[model samples]
Target: MAGNSDPLTPRAKIAVTAGKAVAAASRAAGRGSGSVIGGRVALKLDPDLLARLAQNLDVVLVSATNGKTTTTRLIAEALRAAGPVVSNALGANMPAGITSALAGGSEARYGVIEVDEKYLAGVARDTDPKCIALLNLSRDQLDRAAETRMLAENWREGLAGSKAVVVANADDPLVVWAASSSPNVVWVAAGQMWKDDAWSCPSCGGVMQRPGDDWFCGECGFRRPQPSWALSGDHVLDPHGSAWPIRLQLPGRANKANAASSAAVAAVFGVPPQVALERMYQVQAVAGRYDVVQFMDRDLRLLLAKNPAGWLETFSLIDPAPAPVILSVNARGADGTDTSWLWDVDYTRLTGHPIFVVGDRKLDLAVRLEVANQHFQVCENVDQAVQLCPPGRIEVIANYTAFQDLRRRVGN
Candidate 1:
C-alpha cells in the first residue's frame, strides 16, 4: 500500500495491511507498539506513516555520537515553549522512530527527530529534513560504528548536498571538519567551562594539546574558539539543580554542552537568544541521561553510557569521591552486541571503584575493574546490587538496555 514495487504480491499487501492494522489498533488502544525498525518491533511510529500527517511540516533531524537524544529533547522542549511541536521524544532516532513520531502527529508546525548517526543516510534521504543538527561526534560503539571518522564520513554523505541549514559543534574538531564548508553552517561549542580534550586533532593528525580550558593543535595551531553562543558556568542550573524555584534540573558538563547545542539550534531558527536561553534554563533531564529518581529510601541517578566517550564523561562527573558507585554491564543483545568499549573507560578514576557490578556481564566488568586495581562486589542480579547500594551519593553507570533493566529492578 505504501507504493509497492509488486502490487500483485499478497505478501507485500499483507505487510502494508499489518502496518496499517498496527497503526490503527495502536491509535484505538492509545498505545505506541507499531513502529518498526531493522525488522524489529518499534516503540515509535514509522516515517512513511508520518508523511501522511501534515503537509509541508518542517522536520529537524539531530544526529551525533553522543548528546543527541538529550539535546533533541531539550530543543523540542524549548520549541514547545514557543509553539506546538512534534518530536520523537522517546530516544528512538532511527527511521522507524522518526516514522513513528511523524505518523503519530496530526498537527505539528515542526518535527524534531533525533537520528542515529548510522541511520542518518537513509532517514535524511527519505525524510528530506529542512534542518539537520550534528551534535558532537565522539568514539561510540566501535563494533557497530567502526570509528568516529567513519561516522563523520557517513553523515557527510547523508546530508547529500541538501540546502538544509546545518548546526555543528565547533568545540569538537571532528564536527568542525565535517561541516567546514557548508554554506549555512552555524558553529557552536561548550565555551570556556569544559576542561577535557581527547581524540584526533582537527588541524593535523597529531594529538590536540590542551593548554588550559581550551584545546589547541600544536602541530597545526588550530584551536577551539569561543562559540557565537556559549554558557558561562561549569554547571547549568534552572534553580541550581532543584525542581523547585524554577524547575531546575540537569547535571554534568556534557549536559551543559547539550543545552548549549540546543540553544544554538534555537538561534539558527530565529528564536531570540535571550528567549532561547530562558527556555533552556527551564530544561529538565531527559530520561537515562543523568535523570535522577527517588527510590524508597535513597536517590538513584540513571546515566546512560553506551560508548567510551560517554563512559569517560560519566566517570569525570562522579567527583571520584562520591558516596559509592554501582555499575551495571550487560552485553546482552539489547544493550549491544559488543562490550569492548568497556576497556577504554577510565575506571581507574572511581575513588575506591564501584561498590557493585551487576548484569549478565558482571564477571566481565568485574575482571576489567580488577585489572584497573579497583574493587567491586559482583552481584548475580541487578536487584541484589541495588539493595547493596546504600543511599548517600550513589552513581550508576548503565549501558543502553541495562539502565532500564536496573531501573526496573531498583524500582526507580
Candidate 2:
C-alpha cells in the first residue's frame, strides 16, 4: 500500500496496505505483476484512494489511441529533470494500474500517467491533472473501444471548463477537436501518417477537406489551428519559431512526432524544449518496444504494432531486409477480439523480405499475407520462427498480448 506511513487517512492507508499486500502475494504466486489487482482491491476498499493520493501531486495525464504509452514514458523521463518521478512503466493504463502507480510514487511531486483512450474521460475527471497531452487518436481496438468521434467527444467532455494545459497534436483533426474545448491548449504539428480515420469531421459530421497538411470542414467551418509548436523537415520548431534539431535513440518519424508532443507538454511544466529533448533522447525504448535480445544465438529486435495505424508506424522502424521480419498477433482480451484490423495494414510492403508469421492468430495473419500475395511461413512460436533464419539479427513485430508473451519468452 502507498503512503502506509501516515500521510493518508486511516481508511486510505489501510486500503493501500491491503492492496499492496495482495499485489505482492499475487506476484509471489506467479499470477501476474500485482499492479492492477492491488490497485483494484485498494480502490474497492477506499473509493477515494486515487483522489486522496493525488491531491497534492502535480499530475500529468497522457491519452491517445497510439503513442500514449511512449509519450507518457518520455514525459516522465523529461519531468525527472525536476526531480524523481513515478509512472506506470509496466504499460498499465487503466484506473487500477494508474492508482497503483500513483500510490507507489506517493512521495514524487510529479505524476505522469498513460491513460487508456476509452477511460480518459473518467481518469481525467478523477486525477485533476496539471497538464494533459493529447496525442493523435485513430481507429484502434474498435471492437472494444468507442468509435473515433465518440471517443473524441468523451475527451472534449472531460476537458470542458478544465484549466489543465493541453498539449495537442494539430495534424490529427480528432485530437484538434478534442483539445479545442480545453481552456488552455498548446497545439503542436505532430505528424499523423495514417489519416484514414479522420476523413469525417467530429464537429459537424461533414466530409473533412485536406489540402496537403491543412484540414477543414465545409459545414462546421472547423479547421486545424495554428500550431505553437511544429515539426520541420528534421527539427522541432518551438513557439518562438526557434528550430531545435532533435535526434533520438528511438527509431522512426513517429517517435520524432512523439518527441515534439512530449517537449510541448514538458514546456508547460517549466522544462524547455532543448532540455526536454535531451532527457527524452536518453530513452532508448519503452517497455519492450525496439528491444533487441539474443535468441538462439541470433539477435531478435521487438516491435509492437497494435492496429493498422500502429502497424504502419512499426513498418517505418523495421531494419532493412536480409534482416528477416516476424509478424505476431493475438486476439486476447487485451487485444480486441476482431482480427479485421490486419486487413487494413499494408503487409505488401514486405514483398521482398523473408517474413514469418507466428501468434495465436498466425493463421489469420497467414491468410491476410496470402491475400496480399506475400510469402510467409506460419511458425508455432519464436523458437521455430528463428530456427528458419541464419544466425544474425531478426525483427519481431507483434500486437498487444503477443508482445507480452514474446517479452516473457525472450526474458525482456
Candidate 3:
C-alpha cells in the first residue's frame, strides 16, 4: 500500500486506484500472480504510469539471460543499509511487473529491479536508473528471445546517452559489447561459467580465444575488459588488491559471482564492500530458486534450470555423491516450447548420480539422459517421485512452469 504521496492528475490517480483494486481482487481470488494484470490495466489507462512512478526514485536495474532474479535480490538487500528500498521480490521482470513494483513502493527513495533481458533497453530508458548491472547473456527463450546478439545490440543502443553508470561483467564478452557505449562503466570479473554463447565475438563475428582469465578476438581486436572488482576463491578482490572474505548462504561459484556483481553495484552507491557482502550472506532463497521444502516424506531442495547454462551451474552445486535428483520440465507459455536446448546441456556431468525425471517433457529428458549413458527413472508426478527416493534430502531441478508449480504445491 506504500506509494508516492505526491498529487497526481485526476486520470492518473483513478488509474492507480483501479489497479490497486484489481490487484487486491486477483490476490483474493487466486486466479493469477496479480503482479502483471494490475500493471497491465494501469498502463492501458496511463501509458506513462511507470515513468511517473520512477520520477524521484534512485533505481538500480539488474538484467541478464540468467540469474537476474537472484542478483536483483542481492543488490536490493545490500541497498537496505542506505534506507527503505523497493523491489519486485516475486520474480516479475517485465514492464508490467516493474510497473506494479514501482507503484506499490512509490514512496521508497531507492528501487532495485529485475528487468527482462529483451526489455532492458526500454526499462532503462524509462526508469533512468542510477546504475544498470549487466550480468551475462546467452540463448534463453529462443521462442521469445530470438537471439542474444540482438539483445546485446539493443542494449548497446538503449544505454546510449543515458547518464546511468553501467556495472558489467568483464568476463562475459557479450556483456562487454553490450555496455560498450555507456559513458561510465564499472567492470567486474564475475566468473562466466558458460562460454558456449560467447564463443564468437559479438563485435566482429570472429572466434574468440581464451587464455587464462582473458579473452580476445583476432579479427576485431576486442578483448576482455579489465575488471575493477573480482572474486578470488572465498574472497572479493578490489581494485586496490585488498581482499575481503565473503560468506554466502547460497551455494556454487555462480552465486559468488552474483555477489561480486552486486557488491560492485553497491559500491557505485557508496555502500562499503564488506557491508554489501554481509547483507548478501543473509539471503537464503530468492523466490524459490534454492528453497528447501518438505513434501511427502522427504526434504526437497528446489533448483531452477531453464537453459543449458542454468543447468550447468545448478549441476555443479549438487553433491558429487549418488543422491536422488528430480528434474521437471514443461513446454508451457512461461517455459519456451522448444526444449531442444536440453541437447546442449552436459547431462554426462551427472553420469553416476541417480536422477528422477518428471513433468510433461519427462520422456524427452529420459531420452537425453539415456543417450549420455546416465541412469534415470521416469515419474510423471513430483509428489510421487519424491516417494521413490531415499528418506532424506532430495534435489529437484525444474524449468520455469514446473518450478513454480512445485513451489506452489510445497507452500514455499
Candidate 4:
C-alpha cells in the first residue's frame, strides 16, 4: 500500500484512501483485477491527481506495440540501484493504471511506467518524464486501435514539445518516424524482426526497400538511422566501439533487444551501462511471461504472443525440433474481439511439431492451421491439452486473457 504523505493535498489524500479501499475490497471479492477500477475511482475524484503526483519525480515512460511490459520491468530493475522505484507491473497500461501507480508509490523518487501506445502522447505530456523509450510499432488490436501510421503521427505530435530525451529503436522505421521530432533523442539498433507492417515509408508513402537487414525508401530519402547503441548477436556495442555482453535469464533475441533499450534509458539517468545490464539479468520472469509452471503431470513454460510480430519472435525462440506445444487464445475484451490476426501468422513453420490448440478461439486457429496443412489437435482445456503431450516439458503460449487465466491458475 502507498503511504499518504505531505505531497498530496487534502482532496488528493481522500481520493487515494478511497481508491485503496476499493482496491482492497475488489481484491477481497476476487471479481477481477482491482487496479483498473480503483484507478478509475481515483481519477473521478481528482482528475489532476496523476499530474500532481508525478511532479519532482524522475520518470521514465515506455511504450510499444509489444514487449512494453518486459521492457518496463527491466528499466525498473535497473533504476532500483538509485533508490525506490514505483512502477505498474500488473500490465495495466492506460491512464487509470498509470495514475494508480503514481498515487501508490507517493514516497518513491523514481517512476518507471508502461504506457499504452494509443495513450503515449497524453500520458507523456501529463507526466513530463525525464526519459521515454519507444521499442517498435505494429498492427495490434485493430478493433480498437488506429492504424500504425496514425499512432506514429500521434506520437510525433505528442512528443514535439517534450524536453525528455527519447530512446528509440533505430531498426523500426515507424519508431524512427515517431521519435524523430524530439530534439533530445538516442537511437538504438535493437533489431526489428517483423517488417510486414513497415513495408511502406510513412513519410513519402513510397515502397520501402529492405536489403539484408537495412531498410531504405526508394521514393523518399528515408533510411535506417545510425544508432548510438547497437545490439550485435549477444553483445551490445556502444558508440565508442566498446561491446558489453548482455546475459539475461530470459531467452530469445527479442529480450536481448529489450536489455539494450533499457540500458540506453538507464544511461540518460546516470546509471552505468555495466550496472544496468547486471540488474536486467536478474529478471527471470515478468507477469507470468517466460515462467515455467508445474501442472498435474507436466511442466509448462508460458509465453505470451498477441500479434503476428509477437508470434514471429516467439516462434523463433522455440527449439527447432518438434515437441509438445499448447497454444491458447481468447477473444475476450482484453484479447480483442477480432481474431483475424491469426491468419497473418506463418503457421507452416510448425509443420512437423506436435501442436495442441486450446482456447475459445481454438476452432479459428485449427481452421487456419488446417489450411496450412499443419498437424494439430484441439483440446477442451489447458490441462487436457497438456495431458496429450508425452511427458516432461511442454511449452504453453497464450494471448492476453488466456495468459492471465493460466497465470492465475498456476499461481505465478
Q: What is the C-alpha lDDT of each candidate?
A: 0.65, 0.89, 0.88, 0.89
**Per-residue error at 41 for model 4, in Å?**
0.6
- Candidate 1 stretches greater than 4 Å from native: 1-33, 37-55, 191-226, 234-248, 294-296, 319-322, 391-393
Error in Å for residue 367 of model 4: 0.6
- Separately for all candidates shown, the number of backbone clashes (residues 3 or more apart, or on different chains) is 7, 1, 0, 0
Per residue, candidate 1 scores C-alpha lDDT tens digits across 220-301 of 8767754555544543222122111112277777777777667667655666444655676666667645667776466777
lDDT of 2 by residue, 1-412 (tens): 1333445889999989999999999999998889999999999999988888877778899888888889999999999998778898877999999998888886687889999988887888887889999988888776898888899999998888887999899999999999988888999999889999999998988999999989999988999999999988778999999999888999889988989988898888899888999998889888989889997899999999999999998888887776799999999988999999888999987878899989999999999999999979999898999999888989899999999999999899
Model 4 — which ten-residue stretch has the worst lDDT? 1-10
TM-score of 3: 0.97
Per-residue accuracy of model 3 over 138-186 as CA lDDT, tens digit each = 8877798858888899999999877999999999999999899999999
- Model 4 clash pairs are none
Give RMSD to native, each candidate: 6.2, 2.2, 2.0, 2.2
| Model 2: how far residue 329 lies from native, Å | 0.8
For candidate 3, give the lDDT of residue 269. 89
